[model samples]
Target: MLELVKKNIHMNRWKTQVDTQVTLDDDFIVPDTMSDIAQVILDSGEVQLEPARVQSEKVTIRGKLDFHVLYRKEEGGLQTLGGLIPFEEMVNVPGLEERDYVSVSWKMEDLNAGIINSRKLSIQAVVTLEVRVEALFDTEAAVALGALQKEDDGSGELTFPQIATKTRAVNAAAIALRRKDTYRVKEEMTLSGSKPAIGRILWMEMRLSGALARPLDGKIRLEGTLLVFLIYEGEGESETVQWLEESIPFSGEVEMAGAVEEMIPAIDLRLVHKSIEEKPDYDGEMRELALDAVIELDIRLYEEQPLEILSDMYGVNRELTVETGEACFDQILTRNAGKCKISEKIQLSGGQRVLQFCHSSGLVKLDQAEAGEDMLSLDGVLEVKLLYLTDDDSCPIQSVTELLPFHYDAEAPGITKDSVWYLEQGVEQLTAVMAGGDIVEIKAVLLLEVLVLQPVCQSVILQAQTSPLDRRKLKEAPGIVGYVVQEKDSLWDIAKRFRTTAEHVMETNGLTSEELHPGDSLILVKEIVR
Candidate 1:
């Protein structure tokens, strides 16, 4: 009997992307203290996903759309209104089970806000969700093969012959950790004396930049900078709209049960909730701001493992037959990062003149991604939102949105259509300026990162069947003969066919290399069995 060795591999089982749209049509009532709406200026939205539930053949996703609206009051100034709309969706996924681990990710494609009445507002948004499943199983291969025999020592231990078995090294990536967690950042900052005190906060936004996670012993260290922007109403008699921008550095650590420094980490970070509120300073004036942010993290780690497996085996005395089957493994292809630069000009219509550029935000939406002969082609659109001050007295604050299309090709030598991959998209270094009375110049650098994993299929030995050699057949076989090397013939294959060991054939023929050419003559010698 031949001994067999096996190893367990963790890999992706099934993956799919589902695009669904949820409409949140509800009336938002204006507060009594705020004035009625006359004209809407800007509307934006953000999505927050709840803990997903995985069942047989389906996944239940629940979330809410948090939206903000900036409108000109009928009484003559700018006011803000905000609300939340809840949504639930059921995604149909075949071959999914409760015990399987599922990963869910989502993005907001578009959001539209309209006015229904002076006291009410209408809001709607579209979202897309992606799902991936993973599993673990064992693969059996003949790493070493030898007949068991008692040792000559008195201990009587069975030992394997070193020259009878051979092995080759194969590398694979194994999963070490897959988990999800959240972290909250609480900070406070006081405004400089030169800046005016805030009466009320009108609009605020926070973005996480240069975020990274590193693994340690039983923990993961997180570090990033927060880009904070806000516009508020002044408390003094000036009563003008003032804005402030700040970059705050933050760092923290999260506990991961089995994380280690040697593992490779792939982390996804998102800001699920954020808020900036006004607080009174030591002088009893509202000059300080309190910042609270919630970030959700989806983390995965992989460890590279080298496996030694038996490629082929044969017996000199006994007849041996090897059984093989197909197996698949997920191999890491590459982790690449690239950037695209976008520059465009917007011509304002309806007699609108730009007095000052306030702020700009960008979001990247991927439309297509395909793998070519030696590259990965990506097609996407960058949605930019611009806010500025207009020269018009009636509507001093104005906002506009523009879509810029971009195409980028990354160098990926061996990528294919069946490859498992993902591209992480973001915006960085966004700037907007006025070129002329009606032309607004916009420039932004869009960041793109991709990770590719390819599945490799190979034939592996499953088991070995052995039987005693027939004496009559051995007697009829020739003891020595001249052999001609054919095309694509290996020394192991030729030796096994002639009932001899490869070492004996090489020693008898005095060959220096295993490279065999057509019409090459070789001498064969049969092995004698005891």
Candidate 2:
């Protein structure tokens, strides 16, 4: 018989896999009715994946990519082309059964679109997808604290040692909520005295600046803003290219039952269905426009689970058997933010003057991260790219790329070196200005979200040793002998086999660690006689 104690435990875990070789190859030809293609520009692209279908041997996934293409026509000035390409593939994963939850994400890079001739175009892009499968459950473990009754012939009664324990909060429950809303924007603008009405829209982009979600009694309130920028050509004598900007605010409520203010919400916003039709009006020598779009917000809700964990235990009088398991729990959630800027004093290579830039794009990447007791240290690089036109009043556009190194220290309370963290970074704003000379100033905001997890070990006592009344056992001789260590050998197992304690063997062998090689020599002194 053995002593028993019970405690509540919570565990949350997920295993993720990434596939980068998702083939994305498609070709489109310029219609013979339209003008010839002069220059092809890649504005932006996004991939949308459906829920994964799991089978016995492999999983099937289907998705589509939406990309906008800008082409300068040989006869016409500029034209915008949009296309939707569908793709599907199968991936082999062992032990992947049906009814398993799978979350998917994908990114596209290194896109190349070449114009073979004025009528034929070829496009190729590389896509990477990440899938995470997760499951949550609750369980209990029984631990051994102490016992008072025992009978020993050669040993006296001993008290039980203190048992180490750990407490944590895991994922108790989770749910998903989805909502879609529409936005309407309209504004009046003015051009130069010689500029004409808006003839055509060259390129347009929409990026989320900031978003927040808070839970109510039975609903979730969401708030955010979208930054809309566009490049349009004026119907003037020179047909100049103009840059325009607008910030649209949106707020709404989503229905979610049993949701409280203490729960955590993971937000994913997408342009599931949208239409940005342009209606330009000509007033004397200026241009006015209106924009409209529909956006969707997908959120994941999670509840915290608190647990008490048993770490270590032992028995002095009789042999003890312990059953242990491993689990992971959430530790902390903190938002880190900072502003980093890069300013340089340089001149143009040639005698070209600098016109107004279209837009500044920024991307952040983390190279290394370290965690301390109360803070996190991060090392990363910020890459900035700008597109600008020269002073020749021509239609040629030039581009430049820059890299900035940065280090940030974020305060994380109650975080230790043993915890694991997951990070997601976003850019708040990016701007570039022509400072005095050919010098350019670039400024950006960096936002980081971290999720920390702590792993715990749970143990329970299964059985205790039974004493035999008959004393007909073999004995060991007391002597000091030298033994050579071999593979698959441990000091604890050797001491138990020789009827000696591990402490006495270590004191005699002068060993610092238990790392024994095949040719290492050890001295064992057996002093117990039975």
Candidate 3:
């Protein structure tokens, strides 16, 4: 009689111990939650065990039979077992000395013992093993500042300064295993946020990928969010100046291959997962995470004002007084070739009494003067030189010496005209004194306002013996002719100048080459020989 027993095996309870110490040359700074770790798990399907009972003359006992096993590494950390071993051919059997431990062994099967009657044993069991694995990861760090402030509106101002900071890192791992390994791990966490108007922040974000044991020598796609902040300026005199401030956000990405140590700020990092956390403070606010941070800042100011202008017009002459003595009066009168002086006492006034007497060839005649209740008016003819002065001052300063109405005729040596000279025409031709004390000459252009005479061409009689020449003779005639210099003028310009065909010019000039030089000249004949 044969009997059968069924046993259940708990696969989760099995543990494989790999006792090996692996040392890294440097201390590994375990990155925050953003760091990535590379590892693999293999599955070894159920193993079968058989219970066999062997009957002998001495005693009746049952012995477990063993089976042959073959294992092969497969994709995704999987192993396969093949073949079997017969109980009769087994020289030694690996058994379980204690309930906590079990030893397994197997051998190849031969064709001779193909069939056995209640001799071979097959058992089902689960296998779990632990292997030494290492992963490599790269680390990085980054920072940014805000604009400076001044105390006053002008360049030199004293005010409180503020700045913001940002930093990030990319934690990636590369798998360095004896065989190909594949498994999934949780993605890294990224942190990012905005800063307050008054405060700035130091922000950073990191991206991690690949295995963790060996150096990361593969391409990594870096991606992540940006922590933004707005550095605000302080309020002014009134509370109305304290309005809502705005914050700016930034985001970007970077791609890298092989190993990377340090990363620059404001670079985007590729990541599998990310999270953001916001923290507020009294002076400012900060957004931070295990891998990233953005700092807020508040800039304060006391007061600012415009700079005062300093006046430096010192020692400048503002007024002048003229005293006319007897000798000076007589000298001035004698120098005037055509002088007409006032016979009676004359007082010049009216209109602020600001006047300057200048002479080019004559003198001024204060013929009459009338003194009113509060003003004195004088009539005079300014001869030789014309005097011009601002109405604010009563100084005889010469403005334009040659501007006086005077004439030098052969008959009259120096004669003064009493009439005022007006610029009736050619006003544009007048030159004015520039601010630099130099005369700027201007061109005088006269535009005709009336119609002018038009020229008339009359027909001419030509002595033609046989027939009258066609009126289109000028239009149809070959304007000019020239030989085509193999390397002379271009066919286009040459043809245009002669009003002829480019093909004709090319054929006439060349016979061959298209290049031309300076010494090479082409003949341009007129259509009409005359």
lDDT of each: 0.78, 0.59, 0.23
Off by over 4 Å in 1: 12-14, 136-142, 150-168
Per-residue lDDT of 280 in model 3: 42
Instruction: Report the lDDT of model 1 for residue 519.
Output: 95
Candidate 3 regions off by >4 Å?
A: 1-480, 483-490, 511-513, 521-530
lDDT of candidate 2 over 218-240, digit per residue (tens): 88786777676777787656576
Measured over all alpha carbons after superposition, the RMSD of each candidate to the real structure, in angstroms, is: 3.3, 9.7, 53.0
lDDT of 1: 0.78
Please give, for residues 336-388, the per-residue lDDT of candidate 1 as tens digits.
Answer: 88888988888877687778888878778889999987678999888888888
Q: TM-score: which is higher, 1 or 3?
A: 1
TM-score against truth, every candidate = 0.92, 0.66, 0.15
Find the candidate with the highest TM-score and give its number: 1
Candidate 1's displacement at residue 170, Å, is: 2.6
Task: Kindly provide the TM-score of model 1 when superposed on the true structure, using C-alpha atoms.
Answer: 0.92
Model 3 misses residue 429 by how many Å? 68
